[model samples]
Structure formats: C-alpha cells, structure tokens
Target: MKTFGIMTLNFESEALYIDGIAALSQSCGMECFHFLPSSINPLTQQVQGRRYSAIEQRWFDDEFPIPVLIYDRCFYGDDEHSKQCIPIVSWLKSRNDITFLGFGLPNKLELYGTLTTSRLAPYLPHSQSIKDCSEVVSALTKQKKIIIKPINGSQGYGIYYLKKNDKTIHVKTEKNKKIISRIFPNETKLCQWLQPLINFRPYLLQPYLELSNAASKPFDIRILLQKDEQGVWVERGKGIRIGNTGGILSNLSAGGSVIDFSTWSSSLPPAGKEYICSELNFIITNLPYILEREISPLFEIGIDIGVAKNGALWILDVNSKPGRKVVLQTDPDLKETLFLAPLLYGKYLSQSENKERKSNYEKTLYH
Candidate 1:
C-alpha cells in the first residue's frame, strides 16, 4: 500500500490534525506516518517516527522509509530549536528522491514582495520589511494608522495596531486571550517599546485597513483553498471572522467569532456585494497558481482577505501552513474534505512520479 507522512513541529503537538489524516489514509488504501524534522536520518533516509498501526488503530513506535511525499507542516520559529532543525528539513527538501506536498512560502515580507510583482498586486496592501526603528516611524508618520506584525507570525500572535494621535502612539495587542492597549508619548517612546520585539524577529509594516463591520468589530473573510482528488485547486470553505469591537486582529486565536460567509455577504449592498464577491473569486483562483510560479507548488493555503469601507479588497495575509478552526466552525460538513485533501494530493504526486519514471525508462529502451 502507498504511504503518506505528516512532517510537523512534533508528533504530540499536532496529534488531533494527524489523527484525522490517519483515519482517511486508511479509508483511501494508504498508510500514514507522523514525524518531526529532527527524527529523520539524512544519511540513511530512514525516519525514526511513529507509524499508524492499522491493526491496533493507533500510532506505534517504529522505523520506516520516509514517505514518498511529505506534508510539510513543520512550523518554524525564532527559537533555537527551530533554528537547529531548519537545516534538517532543508536537507530533506533538497533530496530529489522524495517529494513534498508543498514546498511552502517564504516570510510575509517576501511573500508580499513576490505578489506585488504579480497580477494580484492590486489586491495587496503596501508592505515592507521593518529594517529598523526609522522605517516604523516613517510609515507611522505617513499612515497614522498602521500595523506592525512579525513577518513570521501565526494565529495573530505578536501583531500590534498603532494609531498616532498627535505626539502620542496608541498600541493594541491581544495576549492570553485578553486585549491590551498601551500609550507611548512619541516616536522615541514607541520605538523603545518595540525594540525588544524587533530584536526578537523580523517584522513588517502595513497600512491598517478599516476591516471592521457596522458593529465596530474588526473582521475579515477567511477562506481555505486546497487541491482536490484530481489534483486541482478548489475552495474548500470560507467564513467571516469578527474580532472584538475595536480589536486589531480578527484571528480566532485573538478572541474572534465566526460567521458564515454568505450571511455576511448577503448583508452588503447589491453592487458592493457583487464587486467584493467577484474580486474574492478572482483572488482565490489566481493566488495559489501565481505564488507557485514565484515560490513553489502548494497543496493548500489559507488566505485572509480584508474589505475596506469603500468596498476595496486587500489580501491581508497568505499562510501556506494554515489552520482549520474557521472552516471547522463555519462549515462542519467540509471536515471530511479537509482531512482527505493531503492524502489525495499525495497519491496524485506519487502517480505522477511513477508515470514520469516509466516514460523515462521507455525512452531509454528506444534510445
């Protein structure tokens, strides 16, 4: 039988997500293995990880060859552990004998930088890497209301909204599920407050879009895109994520609620609704393919799109390794599709490889 591997940060952290994929792998006539990047032996190409034992219906400690195709879900961070293992994953990716389900996107700044050159530039906000304090001050001066986010952040962590009111800068963030706000007297103070954070990891700046709904809660349309059984891109689901009133982020991790996309779209004006919906369709359909051309092939991506008061749409962020909270909350029916996506795409990749190998062999015989 065929096998698929889930390459995650750790086997324990992603157990739930892995279990869903494991169950589907069995139903699809395939095996599923779970491992961390650190567990692979580069020399032997053998992974010291747990394989899902079908007889026991649970993961058991075992050794196996690396899955032909890896679902790279290893989330990297600025921590030393992440730094240590990046090379391992990098080495794995460089191997021609194995294939990855998705090669993954670069950091936010790089991602936006690439998309800025693509046809999707119109839908992207002006973003730049924060080199130092001056860049943040200059952007804040020009765009009084701006956002400072860790370029490598996920789930709305380490994101701040800064609004300048004369000499004062108001910064807002959510921590431990609580919204916290602070005031800095001037540029000097604001920069001082952000010094440690900037020193910790690279950050980016963007003009904060007015993404709140009429109720004054920040919101955005969260959509999940994935390759289907036939290896074609398809929209799995979409949901409206509404944050607390006057909050900076609408990410569920930042204290947000979910609503059906149609429910929110139906409330918009006829023309506005039509335009927003049209642009969304265009963005989702074109973004994955364009990013692939710029970066690498992707099995799935979660796109966070924001619409301003004037009905202008912006691609706020692009995530290669996306979470399924929004979709699971909004469309429970899609649970099965989300689980089966990686397995099906893995099969697609293997079949393609086998065909290529056969064609090459036939050519050799003829030659």
Candidate 2:
C-alpha cells in the first residue's frame, strides 16, 4: 500500500480534519501517518509519529520511514518554532523521493506582481508594498481611504482600514468578533502608530473600495478549487461570507457567517446576476492555471473576491492552505466528498508511473 503523511506544525492544529482524512485513507489503498517536520530524524530519515490502522480504526504511536506522499498543512508565524520548522520542511521538499500534494503559493506582494501581468489584471486591486509610514500618509491624502495588510497574513489578521478625516485619521479593525476603532488627531500620530507595525513586518497597501452591503456589512465570495483524482482542476464549492456590521473583513475567523451562493445570486437583478456569473466564471476558469504556470503546482486554492458598491469585482486574497469551513457550512451534504478528496488525489499520484516531483517549496506562498 502507498504511504500518505499529513504534516502540521502542531499535532492538534487540525485534529478533526486530519482524522477525517486518515479515516478515508485505508479504503483508498493507502496507510496514513501524521507527523511534524521536527519529528524526522536527520540521520535515519525516519519519523516519530502516529500511524492510523484501518483494521482497528485507531491511531498508534509508531516509528516509520518518511511517507512517499505528504500533505503540508503547516501554518507559520514569527515564532521560534516556526522559524525552525520552515527549513526542515524546505529540506523535505527538496528531496527527490518525496511528493507533496500541493507546493502552496507565494506571499501577497509576489502574488499581486504576477497576477497584474496576467489577463485577470483588471480584476485586481492596485497594490503597492508599504516602504514607510509616509507612503501610508500620502496614499490616504490622495485616496481618502485605504487598506493595509501584512504580506504574509491570514485569517483576516493584521488588516486595518484607514480613512482620512478633515484633520484626523480614523483607523478601524475587527478582532474576535468586535469592532476596534481609533482616531489619530494628526498624521504624526498616525505615523507613530504605523512605524512599529511596518517595521515589524512587510505590508501591502490598496485603495479601499466600498465593499459593504446595503446594511453596511462587509462581505465576499469565497471559492475553493482543487485537483481531482484525474489530476484535473475542479471547484469543490463557493459561498458568501458576511462579516459583522461596519467591519472590514468577511473571513470566518473574524466572526463572519456564511450563506449559500445560490440564495445570494437569486436575489440579484437579472442583469446584475448575469454579470456576476460571467465574472465569476472568468476568474474560476483562469486563476488556477495562471498561478500554476507562474509559480508552482497547487492542489487547492481558496479565493476571496469582493464586490464594490458600483458592481466591480475585485480579488481580495488567495490562500493555498484553505480551510473547509465556508464550503462545509454552505453545503453540509458535501461533508463526505470533502473528507475523501485528499485520499483520492494521493492515490492517483501514487499510481501514476510518469509522475514527477516538481514542487519548489522555498518560493511557494503559504498563508
């Protein structure tokens, strides 16, 4: 039987999801193992991890060779452990005998740079890396409103909305399902607050479009795309994520709720509905192919798209290690299909005699 591994920074990071994948592995003719990058012994290349026994329907502590196929679900932060695990995972990706389900994507700035050159450029919000606090001041002075987010951020964290008032700056963000607002009496005050943030990490700035609904709640369309058993790109699902009223994020982590896509589309006027359907079709059709061609091979993608008040569509963000909450919440009937995806895809890769390892993990983006 083929060996499949599920890797994460922490053993409990995605316990339920990992278990679901393991439960289906046996039927796919594969033995499942779960481990951390730090568990691999340098001298032996053997991993100290947990193995799932299909016969007993349970996991057991075991020591075994590194699985031939790996599913990387590591989410990195600025901590010491993350710094250590990064290089280890990179080393694993560099090996010729191993195969990763997906190599992930690059950072937001790198992603924007590549997509801007593609045919989907018009759908992208103009983005620029924040070099200094003065740039933020200048952008606010000209655009009146703007958004700044960490280049490597995920889960709607480290995103702030800034609006220039007559003589002050209004900064707003949603955290833990609550709205946090602050006012800066002057640009100097704003700069003082921004200096330390930008100094700590890289950020990208974009003109803030009015993406709120009639009720003043921010929302976006989240679509999940993945490769199937035949190595073909297929959209698993899409849904509408609505944020708290007056907030700037529609991410579930930021206390947003999801609704069915069909319900939302049915409420739109005929013309508007037709236009949105056409635009979504164009994006879903082109985005995956474009990223794979420009960066690396990917097993899945979670795309966030925003609709401006004037009806323009903007791609807000893209995630390689996407969560299943939105899709599952939108359609509970897909629970079984979602759990079986990884195993089926892994089986296909293992059985394909001509398959080659083409992942460049070091450069691939992860968020």
Tens-digit lDDT string for candidate 2 (201-269): 999999998999999999999999988999899999999999999999998888999999999999999
Clashes of 2: 2
List the candidate 1 regions with Cα displacement exceeding 4 Å.
353-367
Root-mean-square deviation of candidate 1:
5.6
Those runs of model 2 whose alpha carbons end farther than 4 Å from true positions after fitting are: 354-359
Query: Each candidate's TM vs. the true structure?
Result: 0.93, 0.98
Q: Give the C-alpha miss distance for residue 243 in model 1, angstroms.
A: 0.7
**Residue 293 displacement in candidate 1 (angstroms):** 1.6
Looking at model 1, the pairs that clash are none
Best by TM-score: 2
Task: Quote the lDDT for 105 in model 2.
Answer: 86
